[model samples]
Target: MFSKSFVRRALSGLAIAGCLVVGLPTLSFADGLPGFTLWGGVKGEDSLNFRLDFGGRAGSWDRYRLRIPAKKMKLAVEQFAISYPDYYKGEFDTKNVEVIVKDKSIKLQEVRWNKDNHLLEIYPEEPIPAGSGVEIQLANVRNPSFGGMFYFNCQVLSPGDVPLLRYLGTWVITIS
Candidate 1:
């Protein structure tokens, strides 16, 4: 028979191994977002916040809540543009696009989804006031067929400004 101390040590070792086997998989995100990026030199300030209403799986229909912080909205934006990389082949619901401010939906003048240019342009009926946080809600987004990281850069065009697109931030979206 094993000594009592040896039995206790074996039990503890088994418990540790059991915990690792059960807990390690839970740490992995289904959408492939890591807790921290070690290699990508993306600054925290440049990355925008976003949410996937549905679990962002490949080829799934999802809703995206792309947010613009109040600090970034220093000027009244006449239009907002989201440009993704050419490699991303997701389809957007241009007709159902919305611009939300303070939980109220702003009337959109137009929503343009330019697949060839990889741009989604959203023009509000009126300029979104300065200092108000904005949320671009894409109601019916078709996720890409492949799982990968897509950087969706956000830009804003201010009312009465020289036709220039101001860089707001980037949304690092992940599809599983």
Candidate 2:
């Protein structure tokens, strides 16, 4: 007959060995960079597009969605601006900060900076459905001059009387 202590020791050793066989390769690593750090890719899926639209009522927003083409590197037009062409009818050089996606313009309700996370949360004046694929145009910066891996994470604040900022996902902008 085996003693209880011996049985316990044998089970623990077997558990450790089982975990090593199934857990070591799946472990994830991060750079621990906070506040909008760039990424190569997150969780596999990496096609990204920031669609901007400016046709909605107050406190209402249409989803901005983008599908990055296979050749995202060939995007030539560099002059990107985020403005309510439907509101002010102005183009670039308009100091009003905006989120410009591709070559579209839209008016936003508010822009907030999360100092704790170094994240820029854009608040559209409307409600967007949960878990919906959306577009986010960084109205200011142009594509990386030196092509490489650029990452963008999206968080949305639903359009309502009181909205909470929810993290959508991360976008890895690969500029060839």
The 0-to-1 C-alpha lDDT of every candidate, in the order given, reads 0.88, 0.39
The regions of model 2 sitting more than 4 angstroms off are 1-40, 45-106, 113-117, 129-133, 143-147, 159-164
lDDT of 1 by residue, 1-176 (tens): 99999999999999999999998877754343323556783579988888888878899999998888999899999999899999998899899898999999999999998888999999999999999999899988999999888889999999999999999998888888
Best by lDDT: 1
Candidate 2, 1-176: lDDT as tens digits = 99999999999999999998777655422111111335534654433444334321223223333333323323222121122212221122223354434355546666654434444445555443333333454333332234344445544333342444444445443332
Best by TM-score: 1
Candidate 1 Cα errors over 4 Å, as ranges: 1-35
Please give the range of 10 consecutive residues that has the lowest summed lDDT in model 2: 81-90
Error of 2 at 150 (Å): 2.2
RMSD of each: 2.9, 16.3
